[model samples]
Target: MSTTLANQQRSKIISLLSPAYLWLTVAIFLPLSAMLYFSFLSDVPFGQTEWHLTTENYQAFFQTTTYAKLLWKSIKLGLIVTGFAVLVGFPCAYVLAKVIQGRAREALFLLVILPFWSNSLVRIFSWAIVLRGNGVLEIGLNAILPFEVDVNLMFSTPAIVIGLVHSYLPYVILTSYLALQAIDDNLIDAARSMGAGKHTILWRIILPLSLPGLLAGAVLIFVPVVGSFMEPRILGGRVGTYFGTVIEDQFVAVFNWPLGAALSFILLAVVLVILALSSPILRRAQT
Candidate 1:
């Protein structure tokens, strides 16, 4: 009777989760599978999709130097933005986790997350307003420094990076704070008692312990930054096209669904490869 009851409980738990599993399989996996299948086929003339299996789409993607360059640029930009987010976010999170207390900490945490409540498009548009010709930022800069020349900030690579960093910085701060909070207080006290200074303790104890969160935040920033179309579309202007724009053009403007699907799968494959490469680093941090 005891064995039967245990088995029955297990079955009940599985039954409860079965609906969620089914939904994910249908909603997520099915579309991904369809994309994968379509990516293997060729595009017909006038934007028709043919089901015949061919590697031409993949070949075309690689053969084009511009596409390859854009992909590399996207990866580089994502990495740089992720690095900046971590650098800025780590100290802020450390302060929140270690220094603040009670209501004040709660208030600060709210402030950190409050920006996320607004629509991302609204925020990007605000940046556009500030950075455009003779806009708020330029006017303010000129007012402050009489000799300063008005700098064009909109439709530039730097503007896109700034926008991406703003969009994702909150995630880095939240993750780093969680990681820092998990560190034992005694470890820091032990280091201090051993005559270590604040800098030494931070470097030796806190930073190492907080690395997993840092890595998690980096991954979070990287994944989105690489695939981001909106920020680059609005801010990138004519400086250069990223892979996201290329994929978007194929799908929306050109109406080449098969080619677009192939490009998307290729992008997905690149992301998976990055994640796979980073798995060892993540595992090491955890251990």
Candidate 2:
């Protein structure tokens, strides 16, 4: 009877999970497997007489300083964007979670996530128009100011950062809002009743509990920003030559599929390492 019940349970579990796992195998695993195999090859095996394995694609990264420097630049850019996003998002989240109430809260929350409703490419292109030398921003500033001013912020690092932050801000706000809302108002009230100041309450009671959400948001922003190509290309122009753009060039311009795959795999490894390092802190934040 026990053996029969175990077999039935196992079958039920498989029945429930089979479709999702099969979908993952088809969608994600198979592509990654193909990419991995390509990363070790000398060239793409399409219409080829012979194909051979080579580690030169990976070695080129180490032998050359160019990719490494660009990768570091991307990392730094990610950090800057993430930092700004955190600073801007946390305060907005706090106001929404604690200060606002009723219909106002709902409207504002809608506004916060409204960015997601629009296409990011459209948004970035819009930013390009707004930041041009004699563009909307410059015209607006000139209208307000007595003196003439140039507002050519387009095709620069700050423009790239601005575009990225605009896109990623919603992620941080959503995460921080959820975390902040989950905390009990009673705990804050009790702290205040004990003569704890606003700063003290925030430092001791709020930040600790909401840390996981904040970190998760930061990770979300950082990972994608590090691998971003589109915004940088559109906004940064020549100054936007980072690791991601180079990876893109390998496949599109250079016609080196193996090198592109290797670069992509290396980036994946880096992202995994970052998550692994942060796992401990995230675990602690929950408790």
Q: Give the best candidate by TM-score.
A: 2
Pairs that collide, model 2: none
lDDT of 2 by residue, 113-221 (tens): 8889999999999999999898999999999999999889999999999999999999999999999999999999999999999899999999998988888899999
Which ten residues in a row are the worst by lDDT in model 1?
42-51
Q: How much is 46 displaced in model 2, in angstroms?
A: 2.0
As for model 1, its CA RMSD to the true structure in angstroms is 2.3
Candidate 2 regions exceeding 4 Å error are 1-16, 281-287
Report clash pairs, candidate 1: none
Question: So what's the TM-score on candidate 1?
Answer: 0.91
lDDT of 2 at 282: 78
Q: How well does candidate 2 score on lDDT at residue 149?
A: 91
For candidate 2, the per-residue lDDT at 129 reads 92
